[model samples]
Target: MDTPFEIFLSAPPGLEPLLLQEVTEAGFAAPEVAQGGVTIQGDWPDIWRANLTLRGASRVLVRFAQFRAFHLAQLDKRATKLDWGAVLPAGAECRVDVTCRNSKIYHDRAARARVAGAIESFGGKVSPEGSLRIMVRIEDDLVTFSMDTSGELLHRRGYKEATGKAPLRETLAALFLRQAGYAGDVPVVDPMCGSGTFVIEAARWAAGMAPGAERSFGFEALPSFDADAFAAMKAEAATRRDTDLRFYGSDRDDGAIRGAEANAARGHVADLCQFTRAAVSDLPRPEGRPGLVMVNPPYGARIGNRKLLFGLYGAFGAVLQERFHGWRLGMVTSDGGLAKATGLKLSAGPPVAFGGLTVKLYQAQL
Candidate 1:
């Protein structure tokens, strides 16, 4: 058996535990949660599966090599000695990003230059805008090298070309769903759905669809990538299970509803998700046992005036309380006062940094 490589699964700072749970449930062995991410050991096929299947990870990185370098000369010498061909093909375009802290090689630009020069000497073209990234971190006199196996952020999903103002990311939506105790067996409804991220993600998860099934990964360009093995893995992951439950999303904006429908179609979950245009005042519970009513409503940080949003949230809460009995609510908002204005008995989770603002998930059992 080949030796397992160190894989780091990056998530938003506050979402590490959720991501760790996802990694562990996805069958990655003994994942350890670290600051801002989760660490696991896996072979190259596991790397492909991690990118293909894990929904909460922002990116996946492979810690390919590490060494101690006392100076720039030592760094250059040690970098060149590594087998570049094992990961990067000769003449492949790559980018070197370096960060230095508490180390003799303190100049970030200089460190990047040395690593770039070493890669160039090994017949790799250094391009700052390249998709393939080699990240170098110098901490406490030790230099560590990691390759960004996920080229684009995993949330892109190669779908959702159209979105409403301040749409939620798929990764964050997945984490919030998990935090709210959604396990794909029950139906989900997003009342203030912007572009159907929550509904579509729930549908996909319920159907056992791989989040990256329609996307390409950065590791495909690496020299060590196996096309046949990856294809088999992807084929196996693409086998979807039947879902009796339907996911629902509603928005007042017709454009947003149209975009959500298109996005759901693109994500191959349109059959399982229903997107409609309806205001909070007119939102109705779908026909089923109520599961989770998750919504990322407009807040002062991204959309409408904070003062005006209070009425919107209050109306939302009123509608849910009046109609949807025996349901759970998970709402994302940056303002505690606004969440309280809903008049629901909601418990706020830890604040999560999102889109340059601190937000929390306000959950309640209705």
Candidate 2:
């Protein structure tokens, strides 16, 4: 086993570069990006820093060990042979979430049962709240075990009490903002800002606040988790301030505005942002400044009325063309046909995947 160990930080698809940049900036050397994650070598502080500072990552995982097993009995024997106490403390809440891609152990229940039984033998009970979420991949006859250091997904910033029909993940919202090259000086306006994730994330970034400052991570529950060290890290982080940050957002639904307001208040960014009820067509652009107009509109999933949303997009596009000049646009859409309804010219090209969902993050020059 490596001393400081190598950990993989999972990210939304096509966002490996974003996460890679975060790792590099956090003092990790030359992070290698993969399809859904980036691997870096580090000790406990690196893991803590990644949890606290990485704005684009979804979960931090430690690749503990790997073993070969041909059958279910061999799997159980191999699992019990490895050391689990190193990651999880005695009688800690532990659970295994396995994903078998192109593997012979295709049965999920049996896998879960085997892992659960093995873990239980060591007096650790399975719970919904598992600090250690072990992901096992059994391909051909090879098996790999990885432990999740990030307990709750980082997107659950502990602020969003009320969510919209199609809520955007907070990590994703921040990544999209960074991808747009936002430096917190330019105004960020989300017209269809359901639940205010984009605005709140922007406010946090602008304020120089730690993304996981107010929240807790699964690693906190580990035996290696040091409260004073984490607290000192947080206190050190709270010293920086971005007083000039300008963040703003709006939504047509009255309930969504209320929810956004409530959520932003909890995140301590309510005062930093402006929220109100206004249809995307009537969204007023700020005067005399080049800002970002990013939108995560309804994608016709549930309560997805495409015909009605088309007009909404047209109005938004018209506003972009007529009133908003020099404003950069970042629109997230799952449907290519629906994105065309807006009719914004593609200045920055190509759409990317987010949350295993292939959504195009397009930019338009207006």
Candidate 3:
């Protein structure tokens, strides 16, 4: 049996517990929630599975090794002796990024130079523009080496080519859905659904589709990767469940509605999702059992005037309360004031970092 390596699955800050729940349900070895992500021990195949299946993870990193270095000379010597070729191929181009804190190697550039030199000595080519990345962290004199097994952030599912203003990321949308207690068994509606992120994600979840099904992963480029094994794994992960429930989305902009339709088609969930051009004031409850209504409206700082947004939110609240009975609401916004403007008694979740803005999920049962 192969020895299990430490795998770190990163989520947006303040959403680690949600990611931990996902990791646990996915049958990965006991996942421990860390400061910035979830940590688990698994073999190379588990790494591949995580990259292919986990929806909330922003990136998956393999903790390669760790060592103590008292000085620059010791760092260089220790880095040279580690077995880099076991993970990185000999001819592969790699990029090294270093961060130092409370260590003798205080200079990040100097640390990166030493590590890059050692990788070059081990027959790897160093390139700033390389897709493969090796990350080094020096904190409290303890040096930790980790390789980014996910080249691009996992949220780039490769299906969303067009986006509306201030688009929400797929990973965050998945987390929000989970936070709202959505289990893929019920309907979901987004009133101000710019680009259809929430509705599309709900449809995919209901259909048991893998978020990475249509994309490639960085693990495919590793030295120990097995293409045949990966192919078999992907085939096994295929989902063909039939769902009677439909997801719905509406946006006032015609172009946004068109883009959402295109994105759903590309995502292979057009049959399960329906998008239309309608303003929040005109949104009607779709014909189904009431489910979740999740929306990421434009934040004041990002778009539109704050004073005018209050009226928009208040109107949305009134419409939902009067029309949509037995429904749940989850709204993401940077300002609590704006969320309160909805006049709905919403309980706010922990603040999450999104695109340099701190946003919270305000949820309620309508």
**C-alpha lDDT of all candidate models, in order:** 0.91, 0.79, 0.91
lDDT of 2: 0.79
* Lowest lDDT block of 10, candidate 2: 347-356
Cα RMSD of predicted structure 2:
2.8
Better of 2 and 3 by lDDT: 3
For candidate 2, lDDT tens digit of each residue in 1-366? 454777889887777788787677768854899879799888877888888878888998877778877668888987887777776788977767866656778886788788788788877888767656777777776787887887789988777788887688888888788777775667789998888989988888788777887778878887778899988987876554857656778887899999989988887777788898987777787755788988888777555687887877777888889888888998888877777888877544345665446777877877
Tell me the TM-score of each prediction against the true structure.
Answer: 0.98, 0.88, 0.98
Q: State in Å the error of residue 309, model 3.
A: 1.2
lDDT value, candidate 3, whole model: 0.91
Ranking by TM-score: 1, 3, 2
lDDT of 3 by residue, 174-251 (tens): 999999999898999999998999999899888988888888899899988999999988876656478998999999
Candidate 1 structure quality by residue, lDDT tens digits, 175-258: 999999998889999998888999999999999999999989999998888999999999888778998999999999999999
Alpha carbon lDDT at 122, candidate 2: 77
lDDT of 3 at 116: 91
C-alpha positional error of residue 160 in candidate 3 after TM-score superposition, expressed in Å: 0.9
TM-score of 1: 0.98
As a TM-score, model 3 comes out at 0.98
For every candidate, C-alpha RMSD to the true structure in Å: 1.2, 2.8, 1.3
